[model samples]
Target: MKFAAVLNRDGGTLRNADLAALCDRMCQTLETAGHSLSIDVVAGKDLVDALDGATSRRSVDIVLAGGGDGTISAAAARLMGTKKALAILPAGTMNLFARGLGIPQSLEAALKSFTDGEIIAVDMATANGRPFVHQFSIGMHAKMVQLRQKMEFGSRLGKIRASVKAAWATINNPPAMNVTLSIGKAEIAARITGIGITNNLFGEGHLPYADNPAGGVLGVYVTVAQQRTELLKFFFNMARGKWRDNQHVEIHQADRTVLKIHSGSSKFRAVMDGELVRLDRETTVEIQPGALNVLVPASIAKAEAA
Candidate 1:
C-alpha cells in the first residue's frame, strides 16, 4: 500500500522537533506494515491545498491526515467523491470525530489501524456545497468558533480558556437568527440562537460526539434561547449533555434540510465541521450517503460487528 501522510505540524499538539519526530515515527510505522509513505508537514490552513496536490498525483491510495477536525475536514473537502480513502491520525485535543469512528486517540493505537483495516464508506454532510465530516452549525456555536480562532492560544488548555472567553463574548451579545427551516416538506419558522447539523444522529444528548456514524441521517440540533442569560444557560446545559431536556432546545434528524435566513443580511457566518464559514443565500444541508471512504482499525470493525 502507498500512502500520503499530511500532518498539521504547526497547529496540532506536536510541534517543531516533536512534530518532525512524530512524522518520522508515523512513516516508520507505515513502512513496518509493508506500506510506503510520503509525509508532508503543513500549516493547518494550507492542509487542503497540500492534500489536494498529493491526491492529484494519483500515486497514493490513501491519505493519512493528522490534526484536529478542522484539518481533517479540509482534507475531506478535497477528497470527497474521489476514489481515495481517508485514514485519520487523531492528533488533536478531543479527537471527537476519531472517537466517533472508534479510532483510539493514542498515536500507537491509531497507527495500527492502517496495518490491518477495512475501508467503510460513510456519510458526509455538505453545507452549501462544502463537504464536512462532523458538522456544520450557525449562530452561537459558530460565534464561539469565530472567537476561538482569533484567540492566540498555543496550548490545548489555553484553547479551553479561549473558549470560555468566547462563550462570555457570545453571552454579551446573544445570537438570534430568524430563519425558515425545511425538513422534507415541513416548513418551520423560528428564531434560532444556534443550530447544528451533524453527519449522524447524536442520540439523546451526547454532546459533541456522533451516536452512529453509518446511520445515514443528519442530526439537527437547534437552540431557541433568545436572551443573554438563556444563551449561557443553554450552552452550560449542552456542555453537561442536558441540553435536550431544556425547553429551549430541539433535536431531530433528517437526510436533507434547507435553511433560509430571513431578511437582515445577505451572508451569514457559520461553523463548518469545526471551521468557520460565511454562508450567503439559502443553504442546503444534506447527507451524501456513503460519499466518503474511511479506514478504521480492525479492532473497531470487530467490535462493531460484535
Candidate 2:
C-alpha cells in the first residue's frame, strides 16, 4: 500500500525529536516492507493542509499521522467514510486514541507495528456535525482544558504539569450547568459539574479510552457532585478506575443523545478529543459505527478476530 506520512513538528514529543532522521527511518521501514511512503514534516499550523494534500492523492492508501491526539483526530476526520485508512504514530503526551487502537506508544515500536499492520473499521463520534475519535466533554473537562491552554507549556512534561494544576483549579471552581440528555425515549435532567460522551465505553482499571473502539455505541457519563469534597472524591474515584461506584456519578450507553445545556452564558466551551472549542447550546452527539478505517498492529487485529 502507498502511505502518506504527516508529522506535526510542534506537537508533543515531536517538538524535541530529530524529525529528519525519524522521517528517514519511517520511509526506510515502510519501503523495506514492500510499501511506498512519502513524508511531510510541517508545523502545527500547517498540519491540516498537509493532511488534505496527502489524502487527496489518488495513490495514497493510508495516512500515517504523527503527533498528539488532536493531530490524529484531525487525520481521522479527513479519512472517515473514505477508502483511505489512518495509521497512528503516537507522539503525544497522553496518546489516548493510540492506546485504544492498541498502537505502540513509542515511535520506533509503532513504526515496527505498522510494517505488519492490518486495516480494520472502528467507531467514530460526532458533536453536531464535527467528527471525533475519542470523547466530547463539557463542564470540568472543558474548564480544565481551557485553563491549561492559558499556561505556558514548552514540552510534554510541561503539558502534563499544566494539566495537573489545571485539574486542581477546575476542582476548586467546577463549572455547573443544567443539562438535559435525551436518549431514545428517555430524558434525564441534572445540574452536572461534568459530562462526557465517549466513542465507546471506557474499560475499567485503565486509561479513560474505549477498549473496543468498534463497540457501536456511545458511553455517557455525568457527574452531579456539587461540593468541593464530593468533587474531590469523584476525581479520586476516577483516578482509581472505580468511578462507577461513586454515587454522584451516572453512566449509560446509547447510540445517540441530544444534549441541551441551559446556561445564561451564550458562549460555553467543550473539549473534543483534547482540544477546547465553543459549545452549541444544543449539541447532537452520535456514534457512527465502523465509520473509521484504521491500520492497527497485527496482534490487535488477530486478537479482535479471536
Candidate 3:
C-alpha cells in the first residue's frame, strides 16, 4: 500500500527526536510489509488544499493524519467517500477520535497497528454542513475550547494552569440562551448553557469517543443550568451518566437533529469537534451516516462479529 502521512509538526507532545524516529520506524515497518509510504507535512495555511493535491497525484491508498482531532477532521473532510482509507496518529491533547478507533497512544505502536488494520465505515455528523467526528456543543464547552486554545500549553504544568483558568472563567460566567431543539416530530424549549450531540456513548468516566464512531446514530445531550451550583450538579450528573435522568437536561437518540438559537442575546458560540464557530440566530445540525471510510483495528470487526 502506498500511503501519504499528513503530519502536524506543532500540534502535540512530539519533539524533533521522537518525530524523526517515528517516521523512520513507520517507513521501515510499511516497507517490510510490502508497502510504500510518503510523508507530507501540512504547514500553517492552505493545509487541506496542499494535502489534497499531493494525495490526488500519488493516488495514495491511505491518507494518514498524524496530528490532533482538528487536523484529522480537516483531512477527513477531503478523504471522505474516496476509496483511500483515512489513518489517524492522535498527537493532540485529547485524542478522542483516534481513541474511538482503538488506536494506541504510543507513536510506534499506532504506526505498526495501522500497517495491519482494516478499513471500516464510520458516521460523520454535520452542523451547518460541516463535518464532525465526536460531538458538537453549544455553550460552556465551546467557551472552554476557546479558552484552552489561548493558553498555549506545551507541558503538563502549563495544561494544569490552562485548565484552572478555563474552569474559573466558566464558573464566573455561565451562558444563558434560549435554545429551540427540534428532533423528528417533537420540538422542545429550554434555557440552556450548552448542548452536546455525540455519535456514540463513550460510557461513564470515559471520553466521549470511548464508543465506536460508526454507530449509525447521534446521541443528543442538552445542558440547561444558569447557576454555578447547578453547573457543579450537572458535572456530577454527567460523570455518573445521570444527565439523562436529570430534569434540567434532556437526552435523545436520533438519526438527525436541528438546534435553533431563539435567544434574544447578541452573540453565541458553538463547537464542532473542538473547533469553535460563531453562530447566528439559527443553526442546523444533521447526522450523515457512513460518510467516511477509515482504517481501524481488526479487533473492531471481531467485536462486531461476536
TM-score of each prediction = 0.92, 0.98, 0.91
Predicted structure 1, TM vs. truth: 0.92
Candidate 2 ranges with C-alpha deviation above 4 Å: none
Candidate models: Cα lDDT each: 0.80, 0.92, 0.75
lDDT of 3: 0.75
Writing each residue's lDDT as its tens digit, candidate 2 over 1-306 gives 999999999987999999989988998899999999999999999999999999999999999999999999999999999999999999999898899999998999999999989999999999998999999999999989989999998999999899999989998888889989998899998888999899999888877888999999999999999888998898888876776778998999999999998885465698999998888889999999999999999989999888
lDDT tens digits, residue span 40-140, model 1 = 88876687688888778778889988887777787777778888988888877777777788887888888877888877777788887778888888888
Best by TM-score: 2
lDDT of 3 by residue, 1-75 (tens): 778887877555542336777788878988898888888665636567766875585568888888766788888
User: Whose lDDT is greatest here?
Assistant: 2
Error of 1 at 100 (Å): 1.0
Global CA lDDT computed for model 1: 0.80
Alpha-carbon lDDT of model 2 = 0.92
